[model samples]
Target: MDHLSTTHSCMEHLKSQNAKKSGIKKSGGKERPESSFVAFRAFLSSCDLFYIKHTCNFISRRVQKHSHLVHCHLDRTIGNNAWSDLFPRARSHYLIFEASDHRHIISTLDSKKKKSVRLFRYNRTLCDNLEITQLVKEIWNTSSACSVADKITRCRQAISTFSNEFYVNIRKLVQLKDSLDAALSASLPDDDSSLG
Candidate 1:
């Protein structure tokens, strides 16, 4: 099958790359030569990369949870539904970006819009319960109820209130500091320069 062959080839490529990386490293030591490619390969082998990979996985999971659709931009022609199945939630759209000379897939998470076709591949309880289904329907069918103008007005009002309070407090502090400094200067022996 094509899937099996593709999987095998991918595994083989990874193995070869790993072998090449190990070959570049100094014998019995992790310190790689100062060559740029060797440094990059060493970075791939580093434990920090494992942490970064885990962070990427976390981001992907979060995106999947929040979004039902994904859009991908890639240059090369891909197989039937290979990329789609990888992120099969609701509606997955892929576009080919041909301007970039190199072959790389750029994936973007699409916005959750009203009237989006719901993909119920998760827990059955989510769809089976009437209340849950109703909730999901309400979430998908209705756009943001708040108007942009109302949101802007509220934000501006908050900023104005904060600014007024901040300036008032600052003026009081400044007056208190001036009074304190005058009192302190009065208590001290007056210098000729200060009197002038």
Candidate 2:
């Protein structure tokens, strides 16, 4: 059993135990409120191959006649009909079982993992990469303070150029719309009685 299954088993047992306490009687007539998780774990130890499940329960309970929060680690392993169970969510961290000649390992995040994204051609009207790169190189490689001022001036000029280009395109679009409207009107049947 994996950590997930162990967690699920623990949750099921806990639910059953809770139901028993709340007068929501189970099918079995047994009135034991204590869980059988520990015993289940012990039975798992003597097996050659075993499965474990880890669970994290956040339920509060009354222990010793007082309300207290309890976290139970349920480790249940099944091997050769013998079992050993634990309750902690089987974190990826594992202990070295030198006697069994098995070393436990956990997964770790890679700091050097590279992130990449595809640049799509969403706006074909935008300047191409070569033009932008050349502009950047010219601005960066310029030595004189006057060249910096020139770079700013060029940027402003580019902005104005783009602004004029946008208006020109808008004007063309408006003209086309007007032409289309004129064509549509021309194609309509002229009737003096329809003028309401």
Point to the candidate with the largest lDDT: 2
Considering only N, C-alpha and C atoms within 3 Å, which residue pairs clash in candidate 1? none
Candidate 2 lands at a TM-score of: 0.21
Per-residue lDDT over 8-119 for candidate 2, one digit per residue giving the tens place of the 0 to 100 score: 4332232223222232212223344445444533433422334333222212121122332222122222222122233333322333222221222332222233587543
Residues 32-65 of candidate 1 have per-residue lDDT tens digits of 3446357534543442221100111111100111
Instruction: Give me the runs in candidate 1 sitting further than 4 Å from their true place.
Output: 1-36, 50-95, 108-196
- Could you tell me how far off, in angstroms, the CA of residue 53 lies in candidate 1 after the best superposition? 10
Question: For every model shown, what is its TM-score relative to the native structure?
Answer: 0.16, 0.21
Per-candidate Cα lDDT values, in order, are 0.33, 0.36
